[model samples]
Each structure stands twice: as structure tokens, then as C-alpha cells.
Target: MSSDALLHTPLHALHLELGARMVPFAGYSMPVQYPKGLMAEHLHVRAAAGLFDVSHMGQLRLEGPDAAAAFETLVPVDVLGLGLDKQRYGLLLLENGGILDDLMFVNRGEHLFVIVNGACKVADTAHIQARIGQRCAVVPIPEHGLLALQGPKAVDALARVVPGVDKLVFMTGAAFDWNGAALYITRSGYTGEDGFEISVPGPWAESLARALLAQPEVLPIGLGARNSLRLEAGLCLYGNDIDTTTTPVEAGLNWALQKVRRTGGARAGGFAGADKVLAQLDGGAPVQRKRVGLVALERVPVREHTALQSTDGQAIGEVTSGLLAPSVDKPIAMAYVRTEFAAPGTRLNAIVRGKPVPMEVVTMPFTPPRYHRG
Candidate 1:
């Protein structure tokens, strides 16, 4: 796509002012890095607080008496049982059980709010409208800008500007008034660190970003760091890791499936692709592959699409997300392998360049999560 065709975020000008290297992502020209570079920005967020402009993500609202029930038709999560101010991860699937997009749905008393991948938002909105428009109003809040402030010190920094956020536990959110604008704040983020995702009107985006940056503990972070941080946290990127051809079970996201949506629950098999999903749940061997964590026994960093081969030289699977995990100081990757090789401590080789690098299947979250569960 041409640069002119790409969209700009509300904080585009601010990104330039900070000398950010802008790159095209999800149809938007976004910041990939800043003057501090990826390593420093990544480490800064691990120590202090870093602010990210996540405005490119889509924020939508479903409103009506049947909002939750109507919305549950597209995803495999228990949206109908979601309580007020709580959020849950969900997957929108096709009839064949392939994932369309992964999203987060928040229960807001009278409405259901959702955040979907930016590249898929247009189609997602259309799908929701066509499927459930009669039962609920699908409203896209395009006028809002989203910001994520993350790290060990994020709470202290944000507490100086916004009160009551400290009381929010992980996956919980609430509406608040901050600096004369209405803000929807969630105690969640892509990075495993404790943080808050603040949604504010686009007109106030720059002002709010500047205010947060003014905090001694907060610095402006760019997308480059965001990617590495999430990679270390073992989180999946929508297009690369989980996509139209992947199922939740194949992607190691079985935890997102609530028991209420399973075979014995009150409203079992009600969502899209329930047959295939339930079959996988029942251990019917519908999935031939499984996603697992891989740690390089060598120092070489293997990247995406790198082929995986068994110790005996037979092809197994391929890497979906790989990085030189900054926190771990060793190469780490997430891959899909034949189910037989998905167990922890299973040995495999990745073809990096032209040579093979040994790797072992291991548990993910290469780094421990620091979410505020209190």
C-alpha cells in the first residue's frame, strides 16, 4: 500500500516530535522506535513506566437488552456470563473453527465493549452488523484514542494523574473523569507488566499523552519495544501467530474457552464453530498440531517462519513468533509442532540461515507476568 493511503493515529505528530521511526502497520503509519532505540525502550518498560499509543486498535460497543447474548454468537467465550467491569479474551471463528480475530470483550453494565485487531476491524464490524444488528447496536468508537502505560512503576506514575485506577485489579475496567474528559481505563495491556489501557477522546489524545509523559517515571515508548515486550510475554500477534487458518486449540489458547461454553455447561456449543471446538475439547484428535514454547539451546536467534525439524531430520512444524528474548538473554520462540513433539523438554532443530540450531520445548511467558491481581 502507498504511504498516502495509510491512516494516521491521533498521536502522529507527537511521535514525529519525539524523533520516532515511523513504519506502516495494520494500515496506519505508526512509530516503530524512538531515539532511545528498542533495547533501551524495552528495558525501560521493565524497570520504569513506558507509554504507548495503541490508538490503531479498534474499540467498539454493543448496546441493547440482548447485547451480550447476541454478541456471543461469533466468539467461543462466555460473554453471556460476563459480569460488570470485567474483561475476557475471545476468538471470533469461522464455521470451520479457524480463527478470524482475537479480541477482548468488556462488560459495561448495559453494553458490551470490545477491542479487535486494527486490520480486521472493518470486516469484524460488518460481520457483527450483518449477523446481530437486529438484536444489538454495533457502534464503533473511532473518535477515541487508546494509550497503554506499562511497567513495574506504572501504577505509581498513573496514580499521580488519575485516582481510583489503583483499585482496579487485572482484567477490570471502569469509566473515569480525567482532566475534563471522560476516560475508560482498563487494568490490562499486551505486555505482561502491570499497566493500564486508557481510552480517551481523539481531541484529547495529545494532551493526555503529554501529561503522562511528564511523569518522572513515564517515558514514551514505540512499537518496536511493544512487539519485543509482548513476544517475551508469550502473547500472540493476530496475523502472524493466530489467523484465519488457525484454531484456538491449535494456538495453545484453550484457557480462553470458559467451561460454560464447553459440552456440559448450561449453554454449550452455542457459538460459531462449536462442533469443531467441542470435538477438540473432547480429545477427538481434531488437532494434529499444537503451539508450544521453544528455547534455543544455542545463542542464535531464530525468527518467524523458520522451519522446525525433528532430531531424526523429519519436518515437524515452523516458527510463528521468535525473538532474542531481551529479558531471558537467550533466543526464544513460539512454534506449531506435530502434537507428539509438543511436550516440554522435547528436542527439535530450527533451520536458521542454512544450519540447524537446537531448541527445546518449554513453558511460555519466558518472563513471569506482573499483572496486578489484587
Candidate 2:
């Protein structure tokens, strides 16, 4: 990692003015939390609304006659079926069936809008540019600020600012004018809460953030609580839970792959590793490993890379993401275990700091999602 001062988002100054404790994440200086602490921020978003600065994420636009066709060849998701203004979560896979990264793509009628993980954005953009540069125009939306307003009251809070945000359904995006600035607002988020991710030009990011924060039900949140909140929601952290070594099938993300994409056809078979992925789908590959939720028996929180052992002392899997879930008030973890040992209520043990701690396989989302589909 570069030792130089990390990159700063458009809202970096505002976070500092608000007394946030900044840390390096995804090569950018980001807020871990405000003086209010992680727990308060976590609960604030769960009950009301919390604004997060996520501008470190990369945004790209693919436009041309062949934009959709070109993009469809990169991921397994059915981009052609994506309706105008609708967004779908997808992954970029290697030719050997390994995942490169997971992303969200929106079909915007005349173009495609893509948002990818911050850490992998550079590499991801380069890969897409290399593959589709000849077919479509790939333009990076520079210095744009992405804000996430999440929680049950998010719609109410945002409606007070943007006026019509409540009408947008889940996985939909639109362009709106906010205080004289053109903004792109998407009704999507990672915390499993009903929320919107607003994209604004860098010049007006601070003003927009302040306006959203002025809402009585809105507060400023940071990355610390964001991780825990997503954990409780069972959302995967790109590099941690889902990586190059993991496939969508093993990561429990099969829903993201459309039926048409899975079937070998003129459009479906063109993407990388389509043969391997389609084979896995058709032959019903052995469930050797699967992502599962773990409830820790002890107070000690299990961290990533912890080895999971079967009841008889055989290694079955490893923890990918784990933390003491502040929202749930317990230690919850996500691990990939052999399919035979992944059923709910199956007994297992996680090695925590050299001590074997009892754990059990449980259904994910540790908590039910609160997405606003209607």
C-alpha cells in the first residue's frame, strides 16, 4: 500500500469539521466514526437515518450502440433484460470461473452506469476499458461524491431535501436537481435498509451533505458501523467475503445470475468463463463449500481467516468476515464451510486467538432486511 497521505473524498473536509476520526480505507482517508462512537452511529442508522460519504467508489458510464452488448460479455448477469432506470448487482469473473469483483450496473436507457468497489475500482476500470474500449465509450465520472442515506427513516429524511425520493423503488435510479445542482439519486444501498445513494459533482458535495445532515432524523455515520451493519444484514464485503477465489454459486449469490445468462446462448456464452460457470450450473456442482452464518458461543469476537473445524476436529472451512455485531449485541461471523456441514444448527468450532470456540451454522442476514421494494 502507498505510504503517502491517502486520497480524500469530496466530503473529507466536512467529516473533519464534524470531528470524525479518520482512517485509511481502500486507499482513501475515510471516517471510521464521529465523536458519537460506532454504536451510536449504528443505532442511529437502524432507527433513523445516517449519511455516509462513499465517493471513493468509482463510477463509469458506458455509452454507444453496443454498450449493453459489450458489458454483457464481461459479467454473467443479464444486462439486456435490465429495464431502463433499473439496477442489478453483478460480478466480473475471470476465464477460469474466478470472481474479479462484484459491482452494481444500472441501465439508463441510452447508457449504462456502473459502480464498483473502491479498492478494486482502478483494476476493474482498466479491465473493462481493455475489453470494451473498442466497442463503446467508457467515461469515468470524475470527483463525484456518492452519499448513502440509510435506515428506516431514510425516505422521509431525503424527501425533505429532494421532495420526490420516496417514489423511487429499490434498485432504481434517477436524475434530479438538488439546490441547483444536477444529482443522480439511486434507491439502493449495502446495509439492507431502504435508502438512496446520491451522486453529486465534487464542487457541491459538501453543501449537499450538509443539507442532508440538517434533517432531524439524519446523522453522520462512518465505516466502522457500516461494516457491522452490513454484517448484521448479511451483505458481503467484496474483498473479504467474496473474492477472486470464490464463485457466485459458493458465495450464495446465485440469485444475481439471470436464468437467461445461465443458459448457453448467443449472448450468454460470450462472457469469460461462461463454459465453466454454465457447467457448474448444469451439472449441479458438488456443494463442497458454501457461505454460512456463524453464531459464536463465546464473547470473544472471531476475526477473518479463522479456521472452522468440524465437530470431529476436521477442518471444514474458514471465516471470511466476522465481528462483534453491535446491532445484535453478539459475535456473529460469516464463513464458507463444506456443504455437508453448512446446514442450520450444525455444530462447528472457530479458532479464536488459538482457542477453539464453539459455533453453529445459522441462516444469514442474522437480521431480516428492511429494503423498501414498494
Candidate 3:
């Protein structure tokens, strides 16, 4: 798409003022990094706090009495069992058990608030409307903008701006007043840190961002750092690590499939691709490939689409996302290999520039998660 046709987030001007380098991403012109560069921003978030403009993400609501039940049919999760003021991770599945998108949903008493990836939001909304619009109202909240405040000290910075946020633990959320505007604050983040994602009105986004950035512990971070942070946390990027071709079971996300939605439960197997997904869950039909974490034995950084091979030069799999992880200071990657080769400590080789770079399968979250579960 042309630059003129790209969408701009509400914080565009603020990013420019902060010397950010804009890049096209998911149909929007977004900041990839600021003057401080990717490395400094990544380290800052790990040590203190980093404020991010994530307004490009989609926000919508599912209303009416059947909202939860209707939404449950599209995912393998137990949405009906999600408690009020709590959030859960879910996947929108295709009929063949492939993933359409991974999303977060919150039960807000009268309705369910959902956030989908910016690139997939349009198709996701249309899919939901076509399938379950009659059961529940699909209302898009285009007037609101989202921001993620992340890191170990994120709560300290956010609590100072929006008091009472310190009381919220991970996966919990509540409505709070910010400068008299209603802010839906969720004590959750993608970076595997103790942080909060604030949903504010478009008009209040820049003001709220400024307030949080004014704190001593908070710094404005860009997408460059955001990607590295989530990679280190082992969180999958929708299109990169997962897509319509990947199933939740193959992606190491079986835990998101609740027992109630599985076979033999009170409410079992009413979701899309239930037969295939449930079969995988029960080991009736095993998956051919599985996603696993890899760390390069050599210092060379492996990149996406690099072919994975056995020690004897037999092609085995391919990488989906890889980088020299700033936090771990090592080359790490996420890849899909044959199920037999998915175990931790399994040795493999990445074909880089005609030479084999030795790599080993390891447990994910290269850096341990520090979520405030209390």
C-alpha cells in the first residue's frame, strides 16, 4: 500500500515529536523505534517501564445476553466461564482447526470486550458478524485507542497516574476514571512483565500517554523494542508464528483449550472445527508438526524462513521468527519441526548462507516471566 493510503494512530504527532522512525505495519504508519534506538528501549522496558502506542489494535464489543455463548462457538476456550472483570486468551479457529487469529476477551458484566490484531480485525469482525451477529450485537469501538505500559515498574508508573491500578493483578481488569474520562484498564500485557493495557478514548490517548511518560520510571518505547520483548517472552505474533495453517495444538497452545470445551465435559465440542481440534486433544489423530523454541549454538543470528535440517543434512522444518534476543544476549528462534524432533535438548541445524548453524530445542520464554500473579 502507498504511504498516502496508510492509517495513522492517534499518537502519530507525538511519535514524530519524540523523533520516532515511522514504518508501515498492518496497514498503519507506526513508529518502529525512537532516537534512543532498539537496544536501549528494550533494556529500559526490562529494567523500568516503557510506554507504547498500541492504538492500531482493534477494539470491539459483543453485547446482548447470549454474547458469551455466541462468542464461544468461534473459539475453543470456555468464554462462558470467564468471570466478570477477568480476561482470557482465545483463538478464532477455522473449520479445519487452523488458527485465524489469537485474541484477548474480557467479560465486562453486560458485554464482552474483545481485542484482535490490527491486520486481522476487519476479517475477524466480518466473520463474527456473519456467524453470530443474530445472537449478539457486534459493535466496533473505533473511537477508542489502546496503549500498553510494560515492565517491572510499569505498575508503579501507572498507579501514580491512575490510582488504584496497583490493586489489579495479572489477567484482571476494571474501569477507572482518568481525567474524568472512562478508562478500561487491564492488568495484562504481551511482554510477560507486570504491566497494564489501558483503553482510552481517542481524544484522551495522547494526554494519557504524556501523563505516564512524565513519570520517572517510564520511557516511550516503539515497535522495535515491542517485538523483541514479546519474542523474548515467547508470545507468538499472529501472522509470524501463527496463521490459518497452524492449529493451536501444533502451536503449543493446548492449555488455552479448556476442559469444558473438550470431549466429555458438560458443554463439549460446539465450537468451530470441534471434531478435528478435539481429536487432536484426545490424541486420536496426532499432529505432524509442532512449534518449539530454538537457541543457536553459534553466535550467528538465524532469521525467519531459514530451513531447519537434521545433523545428516535431511530437511526437517523451518523457522518462523528469530532474532539475537537482546534480553538473553543469545540467538533465539521459534520454529515448526516434526513432532518427533520437538523435544527440548533435541539437536538441529539451521541452513544459513549455505552453512549449517547448530541449534538446539529449548523451553520457551527464554527470559522467565515476571507477571504479578498476586
Candidate 4:
């Protein structure tokens, strides 16, 4: 697509004013970094607070008598039992158990509010519409812009703007009035930190972003830092770490699949790809490869698509996402390796630029997550 056709978030002008380096991402022109660079921006978020413009992500509302039942057919999650104000992670799968997209859904009492990856939003929405539109009202809210305020000081900073917002615990959300515009604030984010994702009217986004930036602890962070933070937190990236060819179980996202969808449960095999997915769940079929975390012993950053080899030089797998984790101060990566070699402490070699770099199959979230449970 041409540059002129690129979509701009409501905060695009503010990003320019803040001296951010804008780049095209997920069909929108967004900030990749600021003058502070990726390293500093990342560390700042770990210590204080950072504001992010994630308006490009798709937001929609689903309602009707059979909304949850209709939704349960598309993804492998217990959406019907979701409590009011509670959110759950979900995976949209193909008939053969391949992943279509991963999303977050919140039960808003009478309806469900969903947030999906920007790159897959168009396809995801159409898929849902074509399959279950008649059962539920699929209302797309394009006029809203999302902003994530993340890190240790996020609550303190936001409390000054929206009093009592700190009352929300992890995976919960509620609506609040801020300067006459209704704001939906969720205690969730992609960075694996204690934070809030605020949805505001497009016209109010810039104002809200500016108000948060005015706080001493809040700074404008770009996608560069967002990626590093999430990687350190062991969170998956949409297109890179996960894609249509990967299954939720193979991607290490089985936690998102509630027991109700597994074997011997009430709603066991009604979802897409149930046969294949349930087989993997019950261990009836062998899982050839699995996602695991790797740590480089050579201080070298192992990047995505790097080949993995066993100690005896036999090819085993490939890296899906890797980086020099700022929080851990070491090179860490996520990869798909043969199941036998996926355990922690298992020795492996990453073929970086044709040279075998030593790495260990380590546990993920090199940095422990700091979500607020209460």
C-alpha cells in the first residue's frame, strides 16, 4: 500500500511532536522509537511508566442472547462462564488446529468486548461475521483509540487523572467518565507489567495521551520498547511468534484453553479444529515440536529464523523470536524445537550467521511479571 493510504492513529500528531521515529506497522504509521532509543525506552518502562499508542488494534462489541454460545464455536475458551468485568485470553483456530489469531475478551455484563491484533483484525472480523453474525450483533467500534499506560508507576500516574482506577485488578475492566468522554479502562496490557489499556473516543485520545504524559512518571514509549518489554515478559507477538501454521498447544498457550474445551468436559469438542486440538490435548497424538525459551551462553543475540541444532550437529528446530533482553542483560529467545529438547537446561546450538552459538533451553519471562493481582 502507498504511504498516503497508511492509517494514522489519533495520537499520530502527538508522536510527531514528541520526536518519535514513525514506521509502518500493521497497516498503520506508528512510532517505533523516540530520541531516547530502544534500550532507554525499555528500561524506563521497567522502572517507571510508559504510555503506548495501540489504537491500531481492533475493538468490537458482541451482544445478543446467544453471544457466548456463538463465540464458543470459534475459539477455544470458556466465554460463556466468563464473569462480568473479567477478561480471558482466546485463540481463534482453523479446522486443522492451526491458529488464526489470538485475542482478549472481556465479559461486560450484557455483552463481550474484544480486542484483536491489528494485522488480523480485518480477516478476524470477517471470519466471525460470516460464521456467527446471525447469532450475535458484531459491532465494530472504529471510532475509539486505545492507549496503554504500563509499568510500576502506571497506577500512580493514572490515579491522578482517573481517580480510583487503581481499584481494578488484573484481567478486569470498567468504564469511567473522564472530561465528559466515556473511557473503558482495562487492567491489562501486552508488556506483562501492571498497567491499564484505556479506550477513548478518537477525538479524546490526544488529550488523554497528553494528560498522562504530563505526569512526571509517564513518558511516551514506542513499539521498539514495547517489543523488548514483552519479549522479556515472555509474551508472544502476533505474526512473528505465532501465525496460521501454529497451534495453541504448540505455541505454549494451552493456559488460554480452558478445561471446558478439553476432553471429558461439558463443552468438549464443538469448536473449530476440535478433533485435532483435543487429540493433542489428550496426548493421543504426538506433538512433533513445541515452543520453548532459550538463553545464549555466548552473549550473542539469537534472532528469529535462526536454525537450531543439537549438540551432535543434528538440526532440531528454529528460533521464532529472540533478543538481547534488557531486563536480564542477556540474550534470550523463544523457539520451536523437538519435544525432547524443549525442557529447561537442555543444551542446544543456534546457528547465528553460519556459526554455532551455544544456548540453553531456559524457562521464559527472563524478567518476572509484575501484574497487580489485587
Candidate 5:
């Protein structure tokens, strides 16, 4: 690896031992795929269960006398209304309603537990510190490690090792004792499946990972498959699909902004970019570029940054995420297209390698999500 390559998580050595092909991603050396390859790994996770080491993600806690009120000034979500033990997805916004990052906030007892992307951890921490300052205590959980167990059989596989896991519904979390180690397990994941993300101390990560893999339905997956799975599921990949230049309204993520958080309301928590986001909500944004799914007829895989053009040869948008969908058996992609051209079944052309490939806008989650919402 080059010196410019980012650091590795504690499970890096274990990945090497499993014959994984390592690659630099999100400022960390991560396993992009094991010997099974991306397609096989993706199918494995969809059909059975797969374990992923996501320790590079940043986990932090905010606590203070007015933690919820103080934290609301930083993000648009209404944290004060969030019930205990419930997790909500939110976005850190700029003054212009642009997305700084997408994060998950969980009301853990008296404090708030937050998780953000690893690539933007430094900036996110700095932003939080600068905004909240002395109003709240922002503590980084550096000694912790994150793991994801995903797939159709994920719940059953985890229940065998960590008992009582079946009781967890989607977006709920609980403290559990796993193989003599304390872990925080959340009934949530990025793959649009019934899964759990476990946060454990760094030292116990390897042991817990080994135990999960010991299950017959569990296999170790990597970043390559992770990307493909999220793409097929129509999930946004922060920096690519959404970033500081894209607003929540334009990105079709207005659902993340709860009704209570809207402007001109008694329950509204005044946060950054409230004016712009609220205005867009009342009088729809002029340029609503939504993340829509696309199916390409050409066999060639369409990668990111590919230009999307209308059938009449007019440029519409660009592909933010693309891959050969393992489940759909076709080249599928997600692009931010103008709202006028974002309806499902709209015909378009993707310029892949100088050729005009016929494409069609389709509904998201190319495959039906098999999440166990109960």
C-alpha cells in the first residue's frame, strides 16, 4: 500500500488472514472483496448472512443538561421529540440547506448516541465541536468498534450467538451480552435487509467477529459487495449521491426532516439552514434533482460520473452510483436527474464509454427490501 493510503481498523489483520483483497476506502484500508468476488459476496449476503467490519465509522455521544435542545441547533432533525431507544436518520446541513453529511441519532437513556461516516469523521467532529461548544459535551467513542450483520437469515444467525436478538424491531437498539462481551446491537443496516449493527469495544471486536462467522449462514463480506448491495437497494452513498452541494429537498430526502421540525411550528427546533430547508418544503424547490434508479440495456457496466442524456440528445444529469446489480442480473445505476425527468419509465440514454446506451428510470430498491420490520 502507498504511504498516502489511509489507516486500517483493528480487524485489518484478520481480513488479510481470510484472503480478502484489500483496498483503500473512506480514509481506511478496507476489504473490498474476499476470494469469493463482489458478485458472489453480494448474492451471499442477500440469500444468507454476511458480516462486515465497519469500525472505521465514527461513534460519539452528546450529553448535557440541554443536550437535545443544544444538539438541535446543529442538525435539522427534531431530536427533542425522538423517543427513548428509537433511532432516527438525519442530515447535518449547511446554512444554504446543503447536506454536510447524513447521520443516525439514537436517544440512549439520558444522552444521544450519534454515528457518522468515517470519511467525514474529522470534519463532523470539528463541526459539532465548533457549533455546540460549551453547550454540550461531545465525547468521541474511539475505543469502540462497529460490525454489521446483514441478509435474509441475519436475525436467525445472530439469535443463535446473541440471544434475544429477535425481539429487536427495525431502527431500535438495545444493550446485549454477547459471548461474555457487552455490545450495543441496533436493528438497522444500510443494505435494506433485516440486520443488526453491533458496537463493541475494540479489543473484543476480533473475538465477536470470529464468533459470528462461525455460524453456518454467516460469511465475511467486503466493501465491493457493500457498495453493490446499497446501490441495488437505492441507498445513497454520502459523498457520491449526496454532499455539501446537494440540499435535502433536492436530494429527495425530505422525509428525514420530520413534520415537527418544519418551520413556523411551535415544536420546531431552530437548526442550521432552517430557513432554506423550510422554504423548500412550503414552496417546492425549483431544481429538484432526485436520486432515481436506471436500467441500462448495454452489457457494459455504467460507472459513476457517466453523463445521462434524454432520448432527444439533451443532457439531463449524471450517474452518482452504478454497478452490475447482482440480484437483478442487469446493469443498474442511481442518478440525480431533474424532477421533470425522474418519473419511473422515463426513457433516457446513458453515455457509457462514448456509446449511447438506452436506459429507463425505475422505482428505487431494484429488488424488494426483505426487512423484518416487526
Candidate 6:
């Protein structure tokens, strides 16, 4: 897309003011880095706190009496039992047992608050409306701006601006007043850090961003660092690691599918692709491939779409996300290979530019997640 046609976030001007290099991402002109560069920004987030403008992501509300039940019909999650102020990750599935998109939904007492990927928001919103519009109100809140404050000190930085935010544990949220404007703050983030994602009115976005940046420990981070952070954390990127063709089971996201929504439970088998998904879950239809983490034995930076093969040279799978991890200081990747080759310590080769880069299947989250559960 052309630069002139790109949408801008509420903090666009602030990004430029901070010497950010803007790039096109998900149809928006977003900051990819700043004067400090991607490496520094990424390290800063791991050491301190970094504020990110994620307003391009979709925010919506599902309200009405049948919201939970109606929503349960679309995704394989235990939404009907979601506790007030608690959040859970879920996938929007296709009829063929594929993932339409992965999203985070929160039960906010009176309604359900949903946050979807920036690129998939339109399709997701439309799908939700078409399926359950009659049972509930599918109201997209484009007027709200989302910000993520992440790192070890994120709580300290955010609590200074929005008091009582420190009380929130991971996956929990509450409504708070920031400068008299209503704010919904959740203790959740994508970077595997102890952090908070704040939903603020669009008009107050810039003011809140500036306030957060005012903290001595906080710096404005951009998309470049955001991507690397999520990669190191073993989180899936919407289009790269997961998409319409991938199933939740194949992506190793089975833990997110609560047992209550699985076969033989009270709410079993009502979601899209339930039959196919449940079949795989129960071993009635075993998956041919499975997602696994790989650590390169060589220094080569294996990347997405890089083909994988067994030590003797038979095709196995392909890399979905990879990079020379900053924290681990090693080349790491995530891939889906034949289920037989998905075990830890299994040796494989990543074919990069016709040369073989030896890699071993290992566990994910190259770095341990630092979520504040208390």
C-alpha cells in the first residue's frame, strides 16, 4: 500500500517527534524503530519498561444476555464460564478445523471485551456480526486506542500513572479513571513480560502515552522491537506462525482450549470445526504434523518459510518464525514438522539458501515468560 493511503495511529505525531522510522504495517503507518534502533529498544524492554502504541489492533464489545452462549458457538473456548474481569486467549476457527485468527477476550461483568489482530479485525468483526448479531450487539470500538507497557518494571511505571493497576494479576483487568477519563487496564502483554495493556479513549491516548513516557524507566518502543520480543517469547505472529490454514492443535495451542470445551464436557463440540478439532483432540483423527521449537546448531539465522528436512534429507516441515534471538544469543525458530520428528533433541536441517543448517527440536519460549500471576 502507498504511504499516502496508510492510516495513522493517535500517537503518530509523537512517534515522529521521537525520531521514529515509520513503516507500513497492517494498513497503518506505524513506527518500526526509533533513534535508539531495534536492538537497543528490544534490550530496553527486557531490562526496564517500554511503551508501545498498539491502537491499530481491534477493540470491540459483545453485549446482551446471550453473548457468552452465542460466542461459544463460534470459538472453542469456555466463554460461558469466563469469570468477571478475567481474560482468556481463543481462536476463531474455520469449518475445516483451521484458525481464522487468534484473539484475547475478557469478561467485563456487563459485557465481553475482545481484542483482535489489526489485520484480521475487519474479517473477524464481520464474521462475529454475521453469526451472532441477532443474539448480541457486536460493537467495534475504533474510537479507543490501545497501549502496551511491558517489561519487568512495567507495573511500577504504569501504576504511577494509573493508581491501583498494580493490583491486577496476569489475565485480569478492571476499569479505572485516568485523569477523569474512563480506562480499561489489563495486566497482559505479548512480550512475555510482566506488563499491562491499557485501553483508553482515542482523545486521551496521546495524553496517556505522554504520561507513561514521562516515567524515567519507560521508553517509546516501536514495531521492530515488538516483533523480535514476541518472537523470543515463542508467541505466534498472526500471518506468519498461524493463519487461516493452521489449526489450533497443530499450532500447539491446545492448552488455551479449556477442557470444558473439549469432548465429553458439558459444552463439548458446538464451535466451528468442532467435529474435526475434537476428533484430532481425542486421537480419532491424529495430526500428521505438530509445531515445535528449533535451536540452530550453527550461527545461521534461520527464517520463516525455510524448508526443513531430516538428517538424511527427506522433507519434514518448514520454519514459521525464526531469528538470532537477542536474549538467548542463539538462532532459534518455530516450525511444524512430521509428528515423528517433533520430539526434543531430534536433529533436523533448515535448508537456507541450498545449504543445510543443523538444528535440534527443543522447547519454546527461548526465554521464560515473566508474567505477574499474583
Q: Is candidate 3 or candidate 5 better by lDDT?
A: 3
RMSD (CA, Å), candidate 1 to true, equals 0.9
How do the residues 116-175 of candidate 5 rate in per-residue lDDT, one tens digit apiece? 999888899899999986898999998899999999899988998889989999998989
Query: After superposition, which runs of candidate 2 have C-alpha atoms over 4 Å from their true positions?
Result: 1-4
Candidates 4 and 5, the one with greater lDDT = 4
Q: Could you give the C-alpha RMSD of every candidate to the true structure, in order shown?
A: 0.9, 1.4, 0.7, 0.9, 1.5, 0.8
Q: Write the per-residue lDDT of candidate 1 for residues 58-151, one digit (tens) a residue.
A: 9999999998888878888899888899999999988888998999889999899899988899999998899999999999999999999999
The global Cα lDDT (0 to 1) of model 1 is: 0.92
lDDT tens digits, residues 20-124, model 2? 999999899999999999999998988999999999999999999899989989999899888989989989998877789999989988899999899999999
Given candidate 3, what's the lDDT at residue 374? 92
lDDT of candidate 1 at residue 47, scale 0 to 100: 95
lDDT of 3 by residue, 107-140 (tens): 9999999999999999999999999999999999
Candidate 4, residues 1-374: lDDT per residue as tens digits?
77799999999999999999999999999999999999999999999999999999999999898999999999988998899899888998889899899999999988899999999999999999989999999999999999999999999999999998999999999999999999999999988899999999999999999999999999899999999899888999988888888888788888888887785767877999988887887899788899998999999999999999999999999999998989899999999999999999999999988999999998887888999999
RMSD of 4: 0.9
Q: Which ten residues in a row are the worst by lDDT in model 6?
A: 257-266
Give the Cα lDDT of each candidate: 0.92, 0.90, 0.94, 0.92, 0.88, 0.94
Q: Total clashing residue pairs per candidate?
A: 0, 0, 0, 0, 0, 0
Better of 2 and 3 by lDDT: 3
TM-score of each: 0.98, 0.97, 0.99, 0.99, 0.96, 0.99
Clashing residue pairs for model 5? none
Alpha-carbon lDDT of model 5: 0.88
